[model samples]
Target: MRHLSPGELIDAAEGHAAARATAHTEACEACRRQVASLREALAALRDVPDDEPSPLAWDLLAARIGRAVREAGAPKPWWAAWGWRFAPLLMVAVLAATAGVGVTLWHQRAASGSAASAGAVPGADEALAQDADGDERAAEDPSWSLVSDLSAGISLDDAADVGGLPPLGGSERALWQLSSDERRTLASILEAELAESAAAAPIIPGV
Candidate 1:
């Protein structure tokens, strides 16, 4: 059997060694005696009291602790202020709300203008029906004759004639013939009427 080293004997004496070392030390007189002598010397050293610190040491320690506490309690820098931290977020929110309101107003104005224009147009429903009929006819016959007839101008005998060019009555007939304002007005009226019809149509369910 090998004898335990001084380090192992000291660890066993301090209750930190394995059980086998403890049992071997208990059964071995020489190892047990050496361990007891080391323990007694340590016990004697532990009985000595530590020396007291000088008066200046206590003052220095108190001042250091006070400075540490004061630094910890001081106010933060301007960059860490609450206003600076939240300003960007507030700006983004305000801009988003403004954009949303602007978009809503634009759409509302467009809708109102469309409604007013529709109210001004005469025979809008008839025009729409005629247009639909014309589209169907054109689709069925690629070589349509409607464009050629319009280009040739209408005759007084024709059903679609405007009664001999408004009877050549003063400047009003000339003004009516030369002015494109009527076409613009008619277009505005048609746009309004279409917008109204679209609004009145039944909504389809689901997205």
Candidate 2:
């Protein structure tokens, strides 16, 4: 017994509702009046002709849209905008760092070259010849083998303590004729020289 809805009333006005809605419209005076009003409104709408839009209005709308689009233009990307702002500074920083590193490396190489020249020995050839003589002496006398091994990497010029000692080139037989005290003193001196030589010896790699 509920009153008819607006959609049912519209269907009733258009003569398109079910029989049940028609029966309700007949029984309900309120629904009947609403349907009559809807029908009258629809008839009035049909009687009045719709106004057509002018071509000038459409052309103006299109022109406004085109102008807006042109004004907006394609926006630059966020990174592109920021990158342009800092590009020169970033390039300058990179170049400066590269130049500084190059200068530092060049200075290091120059310093190492100067240090090598400063540390070089003028008597390198003479020392090499002395080592070769020591090698030959070691081969001839087993006693000199210990001396050769102790003096392997050590320069003969560094042996300041033993430099004052006389040469034993022809004094081997006279060594047995020395006094007891002289022999003991000579043995002590030899021991000290050996110890000093061994202590001053340089460590050779892979030996």
lDDT per residue for candidate 2 within 87-171, as digits (tens), equals 5544543444454334434543455466569995323232222233332433554333433344355444433333431222224
Instruction: Give the candidate number with the greatest lDDT.
Output: 2
Candidate 1 regions with alpha-carbon error over 4 angstroms: 54-56, 61-207
- The prediction achieving the highest TM-score against the true structure is 2
Q: Across residues 87-132, which tens digit of lDDT does each residue of candidate 1 receive? A: 4533443444454334434544565567568884344333333233
lDDT of each: 0.54, 0.57
TM-score of 2: 0.30
For model 1, what is the alpha-carbon lDDT of residue 71? 84
Error of 1 at 14 (Å): 1.6
For every model shown, the clashing-pair count is: 2, 0
Residue pairs in collision within model 1: 118-192, 118-193
Model 1 C-alpha lDDT versus the unseen true structure: 0.54
Question: How well does candidate 2 score on lDDT at residue 9?
Answer: 86
